[model samples]
Target: MFHPDRPGPTRTNLAIRTDPDQPSDTDPPSDPDRPSDPDPPSVVMRTDPDRPNEDLIKYGWPEDIWFHVDKLSSAHVYLRLPKGKSIEDIPPEVLVDCAQLVKNNSIQGCKMNNINVVYTPWANLKKTGDMDVGQIGFFRQKEVKVVAVEKKVNEVVNRLEKTKVERFPDLAAEKESRDREERNEKKAQLQDQKKKEKEEQRMRKEMEELKSYTALMKGENMTTNEVRTQNINQYILINN
Candidate 1:
């Protein structure tokens, strides 16, 4: 259950987290070879980075790099691997950062002076049979002995995340603009209806006036019929 005092998560707020397993805001684009998509995947991070392996499996992609503390229990570190780049192409600085993320995930590593970290492409890893949500089995992976955890894994990941999120256009703003256009159209339709009603009313009044004029003429003819018939020649001569 969510706490009442806690603020709800949103795109902007969800972007913030203490763990490196969460994709970095500064992550580079995966599609460096071609023009990026106009609308790409939006930035979505799990609120809890407690179990990184599970998060990686759920949110991580085949191109992503997986990192863990060598023998100690650790959270999974997912590096957004660049497209068309081999494992050797990864920058040394970025590797050091990933090592730091792995160390941070382990309770023992954080206390020790240094810890060894292992990494492999997510594509190379597979989940064991009926394993827990966050658990995974790695057949083989590259290992690096990182003495000082200069945590930059999150930074590189952040760069890649920015690239992905930028592709998604702001839908809320678009929805508002669409709503305004609809309102304007409805208002114009209503005004046009009012104008048409007024025109119709005017036509009805004109027809009534014409009918009244005919009736008045008929009544006058009826009232004067006897006088006119009695002296038709006199009446015509007088009128002439």
Candidate 2:
């Protein structure tokens, strides 16, 4: 049983620990090609940083870089190596942070195992959005594994039972039917609007064509009347 009040063997707090395989803090590796400090430390960012006592973050000597249980939980772990520490010198606390986060967030009593742990250049970690007041980031080594743990299913069943008790099946069905009817009505209205617009456009075009034809006939009639008048005047002049 994982208890919040009591810290168990599985629940390790963020007290600093030493790992023999880690590099010396004084002489961390540095990259010559990069102008900025080559060995930036890895960090795990969380929405809440002031969240007292949990897996929050783990930082240690470059050689001691570590992460928590691999692939089991949502643990944000990272390493902060000295500028002089080699790429391999990420601290063991990196893994520890990752593991602690997994343990903290997982269903109580279930164990997450075989999670993956990996490392990237500190520069690779990016933060896109504004973090809430206490959030931070981390770095971990390029080593990780997937670990399996038993999960508790009782809570899930209990929730389902509660939902069944509170459900209003009849009311829900009525609402669904009403919603479907409304959608159909809206679709029919849109179709009707389109048909109306097309009919109006057709009528306008027919009206315009009729007007043009009438104007052309009137112009022809006017020209014929003028020719008749000219012939009449010429005949009278000839007869006189």
Candidate 3:
């Protein structure tokens, strides 16, 4: 059943499908305008469709070289190197692969240009989600010139894409939701504790007043039974 402001199972019915065997470079309905690459290279780019503005650049040690289209674009590509390979030893095949991967993901009519390659250590790569809410807050966007690649980052991205999708909302989203729910629960718990404390304090004050009244009656000529009768009558009057 449908309810106002609340979405139904219709939203869940929407599915995102990707072919495991098909390379991410398979153009989205090939544009007749794109020039054919005689020998394509390998490169990596983002697999998500929501955010068109984020990019991940691999830097430092090249164990995890990630590359992507620079701009408000969705292209995440990674270069896998032999365990000890340095960035300087990256082959022409790798460069071509990177270029083809970028060209395939971009707008069909994008002209060829020298794309920027950040030669920093792989440790410098920022793993922020392409769909993250505040990714634009921390990083400045720069014009990235795509370095020509000898291979495509499409295959690596395709393999990891499945795992990423199966894990819903990504890690950041899940953590944020859990933290918020926990905070709300904690606040409610504290309020209950405070209420119980107030009730206890009120009970103690009433008991102390009764003790004082009994001490005063002990000093008077009145008997204990007479004092008890007077206290019961006072209580009834106050309650009524």
TM values, all candidates: 0.41, 0.28, 0.32
Model 1 lDDT per residue over 34-146, tens place: 33323222222222234332434543454556666666665555565544554565666555545654564466665675456666776767666566555566555343322
How far in Å is the alpha carbon of 195 misplaced in model 2?
1.9
RMSD (CA, angstroms), candidate 3: 19.3
Among all candidates shown, the one with the greatest lDDT? 1
lDDT of 3 by residue, 1-240 (tens): 001121111111101112222234433343233343433223333333233322222121235354544442423344545455755555664455444544444442134354443322345444454524213221222422236433345553343333222212232454466567778999999999999999999999999999999899776756767889999999999999
Error of 3 at 44 (Å): 5.8
Lowest summed lDDT window (length 10), candidate 2: 160-169
Candidate 1: regions farther than 4 A off: 1-49, 53-55, 140-240
| Count of backbone clashes, every candidate in sequence | 12, 58, 45
What would you estimate as the lDDT of candidate 3? 0.42
Model 1 TM-score (2 dp): 0.41
Residue 216 of model 1 has an lDDT of 100
